[model samples]
Target: MVAPTTPGTTPTPTNDAPVADAAARLNRLADGYLVTAALHVAAELGVADVLDRGACDAERLAAEVGARPGPLSRVLRLLVAEGVLVEFPDGTFSLTPSGRLLRSDVPGSLRGVVRARGGVYATAAPALAEAVREGGVAFERARGEPFFEHLAQHPAELAAFQASMVDRSARAAADVLAVYDFGRFRRLVDVGGGFGVLLSAILTATSGVSGVLFDRAEVVASARVPEGTEVVAGDFFAGVPAGGDAYLLSWILHDWDDADARRILTRCREAMGPDGTLLVVDAMLPERAADGPAVIRLDVTMLLLATGCERTGREFGELFASAGFTLRRIVPTASPLGLVVLEAVPA
Candidate 1:
């Protein structure tokens, strides 16, 4: 039988019903585990990195990652559905632009995130129901400790977590650098900026901008931040580094409760210059769904995994207002992530 057609309108056959139906079935949310595991494995194995040199059969990639060809080929085919890779009739494969992101050395590499989800993030998924039930973080159910406490216990995992934020910042940085004029700012303090990825990205792009990366002592020690970065180890709850023209936090507030987040922003408010800018880089939990699913999934994941939850534009405005800073502007960046700018003017 032929697929149904509706006049000039294309009768787009939705769902798994084609020759590639078996794999498409796995790709759909019906088999969440299949896609989840496949993403982790492919990202971990550096399939994109390996294939970047040239296309070869599955056996070669498995050899590079120290795995078995039989199993790896099945994984590669899974990604092919998502456009991460492609297989031709001759039996070899190649990279698509989307797949290039998994390469560890790539500019916007998400290899760390890919590896992380299979580990901690995977564990956290099950806690979503618990968190929704209790109205608190479900990290304990996932890691048997609070998010920060777990980070303290597994130093390496925490380090990788920080690095992944930097990896993400590379993409957001390009947008920040392009849209915002940093020439007027003399100093920038990256409050809870993780491994200084956002700070490094912004500073590297803006000449004559000095930076202070404030975080826990352990996190600061682990960040292999690039040049001209001063590491200040302290809790954002206590106080941020002083004398900066700007204070920034990327994906930081979503890791804490509103009261704590407000307290942290208050510190930033106290530290800034009279006309300083405070920038927050992370997803703004939309009042209604955006045209995509990434942010929605990420917001829910934050609800399950951390003490924080993603916020809407108004939610951010309230947080900044409570912290004694005024919400200035909301700039949609080059990436899906948006930037929220709050200003501290003399009262």
Candidate 2:
């Protein structure tokens, strides 16, 4: 009979252990889509919110979420294994730390992101093969239109995407404000600023500085800003309002290809004073794939959603140089989205 190893001692390496571990990892990678689909279903059904009050058995959870007990229970069990939920001996489930993020009322809730990925982006994933074969957005290929055009046509989808952006930006804005000094600039123009949420947050953070929220006519028209901030409507590709000491392109440049990105930057350059600062807040990819899987994932999403791509610092530097701006420095932030504040100035 084989003897069991002591708790504190290392077990003798079996030749099969490493191979088994590798196979497990590979299997997990293969099954990743299942996790995403389950999370989407949970977010859509408000399962997290249902459990927010207290733990509940699968049958009760199903009743509250309007799902069948059998399937819902299985999904919940999967979530339990995934660490998003904790299953008790009595067969009741409660939220885990990660699970709390799905609640709508939470401070940094990712409910919007969950909905967007599952409902909108998931449907576009299969078209990625087509996108690679051709040279356009997979979303365009799947849905018969570009991402924004599709959003414009469908109000529900548009609302969900907007909400997702807000959810993403809300966390990022705080992280940005922590690292970047918005107080240094007098007049800051937020180009392509949606709903002025980030701008409002910035302005609130810095009392001395005023800001302009620039976006589409409809977007700016509905935007609510603090007293010192202004909401302006126009196409950024055409021109931006002049005389701002600082220009912000938050979560903007990643939506287009190099040509379009250059055009947008050119517009900013034209609008910017010689000494004006240009701050671009976007996801920056790391050199090592292991360092930034989330960024790489988003890059794939961009490949499918728009004619855009996430860039490295070198790529961004090249892009800025092409637009007659010299890259100053890329500031890192604490946001989980891996947002980098890229600062530049007109050449």
Candidate 3:
């Protein structure tokens, strides 16, 4: 039955339950920051690592991690609700399979990522609206310094950031090896290859292929590369290491906008021989939003953090053309990070 209304008045809805339900869902979506904060707290406290030994009540866990019992218990309950942990009948909580990834000592660990998200990235999130209204990088605007510059000043945060990259590259390296033939190249130069995770993996997989790991002096100072692999430190904008049949730009170009990306490509073009292959490992933004939700989300992160963007295949092609290279092929990788190897050759 419909409600009656005056001639000039709007009628009331017969059912408000669906509207209320939709509002509830929207509210949950808006509260996502709370989840991120909770995860960050857990990561900082090393909850997953402590629980790896055995399930324990929050009070004891709090004692181990130097947190308040009641508050930590509430946070643990929230994690259990979020499926990162499971509560036992006896009231102790245990890590779920997904929660195990938060352990700092484990392979594919995301503790560093959680810390980064909850720390440095979270600090920049509030400025997103301002950035949209006033054109500027959200992170720099919020922190009063560039992303890399800030990281350079904060060694602990830099380590967390680097660890996150290592985890991502470790996962992507296997997928890259599976899809691409690194054995074909005589010398492979990994430009801006932080920590040499991907470069070392390639050298191990491909025999007789010498490698050069290049990046900023500070970054390459602590890098661990395979035996006989040369490590050089320099600005990619100024120049890159030369004399390689293959120049690898793994996870680099997307950190800058088109103009800077083109400059990087130009440098790579100058550094390599006429027949050298340029392999760019990055996430290719899908034409449709629904097709690559993760990549789209990363694009937003890039907007918030740096003067960079994830681009579609057409954009990459255009950028390559501007830098005297032809887009040869984009080899898809099975990496969960949504990475693809964009192979190019000099024009």
Candidate 4:
């Protein structure tokens, strides 16, 4: 038996133990889909919600979740192995801290995200290799249509997608507010602001700032804008409404490829005045993938679902320059989503 590392060396020595550990990691990576499926099942069945009250026997949990006793017990046991659930000798299970995120009502609950993954992302997973090879969207490859077009036809999936965005936005909204000061701007326009979640939060936090929530007619119709805030429905590709001291494209640009993203920014630039600011709040990919795995994973998600690609700082600067704006600075935020505020000004 040899030690995996040499004393005071930078890199670990390639001993048998290190090789075995690496092999185990590869094995876990290969079987990652099993964990995803188990998590999706728990979320869909409301396992955490049921266990939120207290621990219960597998039989009781199975009955409550409308699953067969044996199968449900197996799922619970798997969850226990995954550290999402704790099983006692009495054959009962309870939610772990990680499992509580599956509860729909919690502050930062990921129930909607889990549901979305299970519903659409899982379907698109098989097309990833094809997407890499053919240079087309994976969701379209799997479903025979674009992701948004498919969502339009499926109301349930649309609802789940919207809910998932809301859940993600809840944290991002707070992060945007914490990092940026909106008080300097009299008028703030949120371009492609879905449901006005971040806009509302901004207006509430910074008094005396009016906002305009702009999106499609169907999306804006259901949005609840704060009092004194204006809601205008329109597409950013065609044109964005004019005359705002600050324009926000929160989590929007990352949904398109370079050409389409440039089109969107160009429209915003046309609407922006000489002194106006363009703030794009989204994940800015780090130089090293290991530095920010979540953001890199999000880029993969973009590849699967949309034409988007998460840009590095240099990439974003180029995008801004092409759209007739100068990239000013990248502001970091406290959100776990690894959000960054890209502040740009008219060139």
Best by lDDT: 3
> Tens digits of per-residue lDDT for model 4 on 1-347?
44456688566545678778889999999888888888888988899999999999988988998998898888788889999999988888998999999998688899888888877788999999998998899899999998877887887787778778878887788888887888999999999898888899899999888999998776787788788788998878999989898999999989999999999999999898899999999898889888898998899999989999898989999999999999999999986657999999999
The candidate that achieves the highest TM-score relative to the unseen native structure: 3
Colliding pairs, model 3: none
Score candidate 4 by lDDT: 0.88
How far is 134's C-alpha from truth in model 1 (Å)? 3.1
Worst 10 residues of 1 by lDDT: 338-347
TM-score for candidate 4: 0.91
| Clashing residue pairs for model 2 | none
Which pairs clash inside model 4?
A: none
* Positional deviation of residue 271's Cα in model 1 after best superposition, in angstroms: 3.1
lDDT of 1 by residue, 126-226 (tens): 77687778766777776778877788788767856766676777777787777777767888888887777777777777798888888888888877677
Ranking according to TM-score, highest score first: 3, 4, 2, 1
Clashes of each: 0, 0, 0, 0
- Error of model 3, residue 286, in angstroms: 0.7
Instruction: List model 2 lDDT by residue over 96-186, tens digit each.
Output: 9999999995789999888898878887998988779877778988899888878777777876787788888888889998998888899
- TM-scores vs. true structure, each candidate: 0.85, 0.89, 0.94, 0.91
